[model samples]
Target chain A: MGIIDKVRKVSETVWEIPVTYKEGMRAPARIIATEKLVREITAVMDFQSAASRQWMWA
Target chain B: MDVGVGGVISPGGIGFDINCGMRLVITNLTSDDVRPYLKEIVDLLFQRVPAGVGSHGFLKISRQEFREVVEQGARWCVEHDYGWEEDLELTEESGCISGADAAKISERAIDRGYNQIGTLGGGNHYLEVQVARPEDVRDKELAAKFGITIPNQIVVMFHCGSRGFGHQVATDYLQIFLKVMESKYGIKVLDRELACAPFESPEGRDYFAAMKCGLNMSFANRQVILHRIREVFSEVFGRSAEDLGMRMIYDVAHNTAKLEKHTVDGKEKRLLVHRKGATRAFGPGQEEVAAPYRDIGQPVIIGGSMETGSYLLVGTSSGDQTFFSTAHGSGRTMSRTKARKLWHGKQLQRDLEARGIYIRSTSWAGLAEEAGAAYKDIDEVIEATELAGISKPVVRFTPIGNVKG
Candidate 1:
């Protein structure tokens, strides 16, 4: 499973997206209830993470 | 949320605009006095106080002067003749936070804030001329102490923050922490957005120092805006700000983390109190509260949605469980984009105007985005807040005239 599946949600309000999901992601990404407010924020983070990983590989 | 000492200090937790807050200025003028020249007054305020995105402010300070603003905060504005000396005493942190090392601020940060002082940045943030609705004053003694004895007494409240400078500071630090989180600190976070170092660590120390600069910058920003607001009032009323009793009620940051001493287990303990979208609701007898209001309590301004009336509340001793903190405002029930889709700015503007509330804005679309329906009912929220024993309402301020850009 890729990084998205590594999410370990502690509760409804908190979840941890682990480093194994994305390379060089030094830390996990925690999503609180507020993160669900706008999909755009998570989308931007995903795009940035992918771009940064590509750059690191390049 | 408790950020462990020397633990991670998340920029996300502290918020991007570090000390983004509100300022309340009291005036002796009444609704009757302002009714005659409401349009002219709001128009003059709109002309004087720059609002909206990419707005330039009055003071064009050099890089060095910018550093002074970060170091001295609102005191810098007072020293430069933008504010009076007494204003500082009424402000949270006395209008300045010490340990703000401007050196922690980047050249990029300086450039972003160099000319933005005195400008009210966009969205939700506004400059409103409100009148104390007589019947809404809960604690008559507290209201009187806050100079709100007379019904329809005028007051001005403006909300803004460190603007681009604070944004850049948060961005820069997040990157630095992300790079150093594992290597230097041997610390891992639950999220990259929660990137932080130990408070005692070099990175943590630097972040706090830089964050303090953002706090200071916000105070300076509000001070300059208040100066401009005073100018507008003075221009319209044909009286000096002093004669108009345009004194500061209080200024408090809704986003900030401070090392404050609070009682725990019946013993005073120092805690790294970080309040994002929350404010300090210090009860009576806290030495930090200004002398004039020391016996009363710290003033807490809860900004309701633009249409609904805002409130002036004071902390309660019962709020100790909350670390003397309370909700900053009525949280949004809907998104801005969604609100814009549901309401037309022109129609909303007309509807508000018909209610005797005169408002000026640069973008009607932005105005629509701040529709009253977008937020939770402020009255209900305030009732819940007081019922929670966090704070007690003092005076209800209904917006009569407001300016936005």
Candidate 2:
């Protein structure tokens, strides 16, 4: 799934990926960004890979 | 953004040279005092202050003396009569940043810096004369409070930095940081150019120290140029610089890493602030600001490309949101090669002269790259900063005569 799909929408510009959603996350992923930024972030798979790597620790 | 150190250097961060920068000096002179002999004043300044690549100043000192320049910064120049003792008080970090170890500087770096002091080194560096707006004249009461309007009514501005020495230092560290990042830190890379060692690592510390030396070197270099500019003014106008009110208002560094305390959450935290192509916009009441300006905010000098207008801004409290930072220049829109292909130096010079903007430079290629068309509209950038609540504009300055390096 795309990273955006995994994130819980908080506001038009903000999103939250709860710590419990990841396996080994040290902290929840809170993105203070615009809709455009969210779209841009999800377009890159590398962020998903990195996010998954951090999830391993959770 | 979380990848940490993206592959391509952000022109916003790396700039031309990692630390290429500028300093601003507020003079006490009025426009009238400078008008009668503006041509002669510019000529004298051009002769005294070396321009172009590989340019050297009148001062010749030993390696040991040069080391002192790197370590002591503008203090070294003040001791040698290049600047006044009070001048240091107005400079960032009092014109000196600690941890500069001359021994760490490479031979080539030293060679490049040896004679370049006091020079207006080539590419983007320039000396400008400007006047405050008419509104400021009506608000003399307010202007006097901030030392904004001077007696002679003209502000002398210059943009330059450590020159070749700084470039070499950045080059040296980039190589070392790259090797250390891989061999010792186990950091797998993206772009080789974004090479870095951990902030607290040994290699990182070494680079920081060397960068301080670069910072100090530029301070001393500018300090010396200030003296030369004073001499030129005195000789051309037949009046001492002091009589012409050539007092320094303030000087600030554009590129450098600094350690500062700021509110991170609810409490204050100290963080290493790296401002590459950004200038610090410390708000009023901050202890770091000079006492005279403490109530009014730190002066933010934004130099435009030679063909455009420059601006004087003030740091707003809201800037704390962005780590007290703002954009440095117009930001280049074209590479040097592309600019040269599009514009001819002589034609550009003629065009500027027609517009009543005088320009003097050593290289045609340098002039072309600095064409106003080669950069973003400075007014728009400043406007964006204001809209973003990053900075507040105080006054706008249009250049009369320019000495390009």
Candidate 3:
């Protein structure tokens, strides 16, 4: 499954993927976006792999 | 998200352009007052403010002075008469983060950025003139406090960053981190761009100090640009910026990681907040907020595509859920390459002009890349942030004039 598939809705405008989704992740990754935004964001380019990787916990 | 004090510091988290930010300036003039000269104002601004890729600033300063510029940030600009002293207070971190150390910067970075102040770089960077219609004010009292009292009030907003200097800083440190991440630090990363060092490590501390230089440089750049904007308005309207009521609303950086104290599980601890494509949105009564806005909240400027409009928002106490951070802009829905293929810049310009927006661009291709359809709906993003209680909208500003880099 893609990163988007693993993303769980945390709030009306927030979504998250736990550390289990990707190895080496120190903490869960969160996105502050609406459902529409989340869909659009994840479907575009390499956001699921490359760009989303950059969004990992610092 | 809170990267606790003991957490790592990733240069990638801050992005290439350190301290990329938005600045809003409110003017006493109304849309009616500026309508007659919209084209003239945009043309003059385009000519005066350097824009586009590799654009050099008009200012001539020695390398030593450039070091001071990066270290002191906007304060250096005000000291050199490029801005008003009061402009500093309205800026984030009073326009100068205290920890910036020019000594930590690479010589190569210095060479790239020393002459880049007062410039708007290419790729989605722009200077726009907007107006706040009476109906656009979501909160009349709040909007009035932000200098949007009169109907159709004119305001100037711009988005840019530390230019090449910031990029070089990130590049320099990324390479160093790559060398040390696995070998010396025993840290593994998925991508090279994700290279990082421990926050307490020497390499990380050095990068942090160097990054501050880039942060300060961006503030200085915006300060100088604001000065030029004031000059252009004065020249065109035949009145001083002060007489024209051209005062700054606020300057907020969207990128950069900083150490901040926050309560987690009922204990206050320092967390290194890394806000990439996100903005700090401290709510009311925050001591870090400017004195004038401390009672209300820090002003947040959200830039939309040139074709659509932008927003003036304020932070909310409820933003603590995300460490007091909010979305930076209408995140792109389509890639620049795809957008360029979809829109013709010349035709887009004409269409926008017919709708009462005047635009000047450095390149047609660049202009096409920033087409409104290229980005997600800004109104939707604002509504989401509002529903999430991260930020509260004060007013919306429609673009009347724009200079795209």
Top-lDDT candidate index: 3
lDDT of each: 0.81, 0.72, 0.90
Candidates in order, TM-scores: namely 0.86, 0.82, 0.96
Across B14-68, the per-residue lDDT of candidate 1 in tens digits comes to 8788888989999998899999999999998898888988788879879998999
Q: Kindly report the docking quality category of candidate 1.
A: incorrect
- Which regions of candidate 1 are displaced past 4 Å? A1-58, B1-5, B265-268
Root-mean-square deviation of each candidate, in angstroms?
Answer: 6.7, 7.0, 1.8
Q: Candidate 1, overall lDDT?
A: 0.81
DockQ top scorer: 3
- Worst 10-residue stretch by lDDT in candidate 3 chain A? A49-58
- lDDT comparison, 1 vs 3, better candidate: 3
Candidate 2 residue-wise lDDT, A1-58, digit = tens: 6666777876554467777664545467544334554454445433444443321111
Ranking by lDDT: 3, 1, 2
- The 10-residue segment with the lowest total lDDT in model 1 chain B: B1-10
Error of model 2, residue B398, in angstroms: 0.9
